[model samples]
Target: MSFALYLAIMMTGDQIELVQESFAHVLPAAAGAAHTFYDRLFTLAPETRALFRGDIDDQGRKLFLTLAAVVDALDQLEKVVPVARALAIRHVGYGVEERHYSIVGVALIETLRGALGVRFNPETEAAWTSAYAILSGVMMSAANETASVKHVVAA
Candidate 1:
């Protein structure tokens, strides 16, 4: 199914609204949260750290921007999913594995909780979880399909 359609089926409008609102509130702290997310990701999966060799500050900013874009585009995910898939394809060159997505999600949630403080309530957390799952699932599926095509081309 299309990522947008799948997400509509999997998530309620309330869930999407909660996540978007919570993320907007947390936007000011996005840079710090992004940094925290990367730090936690490195701590959780050290092997993935080497994939980043450039300036971390820029990378963090980019991550936050990308995340914000995704959150903002939840209602029009068809437009965003292609960009996410492109990102997945790029990450393949950076040696990103499928397992890293889950670790990144965990780190992202922890970062949001830390940054948002008491604002990250149960309902908000659930919404964020659903959003992350849908986004990550789309990225991973696209990455896998791209890899398969690459492998076939190589063979």
Candidate 2:
């Protein structure tokens, strides 16, 4: 399926509320959540480990901060799209591939489940799934566009 199709399937208002509310609970333990997320990501896609050259803790913190910002701007996604696009382009430079987004999404859902425990119900999971789908769709689309430009220039 095309990224545009993924983009068309947006989260419902209730789903957005669920994600934001659950994420609020995550903020207090953001450091630990970040660590768990990386652990899950690395375990699921060990090859992804090679992409990070910096301290894991530092990278985790940065990832958490970015997630926080994205969650905060969920209702106004336009505000986040430019940032997400630039980040996606940068990830392309860092050897990130399209498949990695699903890996990260799986890791994210698992991390949230671990962090939220009993609170991470099916509804909440569905909400996050929807949110990630849209966000990753936007990112992958941006990355593809960047790659296309690069290919054209090279050709």
Candidate 3:
């Protein structure tokens, strides 16, 4: 879908602006927030911890960089959805399930709130929620499609 069409269907301009502004405030402290996010994620869903076979620090950096790309592309979701879908398919190989997305989203918002302190308001929270939902939904759908293809090929 086109940018305008996609935006109308899900996230609004105001929500995008809120997400951009809130994330910008926390970007400088992203490393710490990344750590916090993973900590929270692991705590919330311990079973998901095994998926991180690599260094936590390295994984955190990649996560933040990917998040930055997603945030930056909020105005042009068409540009970000493909990347999100690709990442989702890759995640399936890492043993990441669709349910993990919600845990990560909560952890992410909590990380931002902790990192940003007073800057993380209700509006910002709502925006991030909407943004993450859109991104995760695309990724989950792609992952499911990939799984279906694999099953068909195997059969």
Best by TM-score: 1
Where does candidate 2 stray beyond 4 Å? 1-9
Q: Which ten residues in a row have the lowest lDDT in candidate 3?
A: 1-10
In model 3, residue pairs whose N, Cα or C atoms come closer than 3 Å (at least 3 residues apart or on different chains), thus clashing, are none
Cα error, residue 9 of model 3, in Å, equals 3.0
In order, candidate lDDTs are 0.89, 0.89, 0.87
> Is candidate 1 or 3 superior in lDDT?
1
TM-score winner, 2 or 3: 3
Q: Residue-wise lDDT of candidate 1 within 83-153, one digit each (tens)? A: 89899999998999999999999998999898888989999899999989988999999899989999999
TM-score of each: 0.95, 0.93, 0.93
Clashes of each: 0, 0, 0
RMSD of 1: 1.1
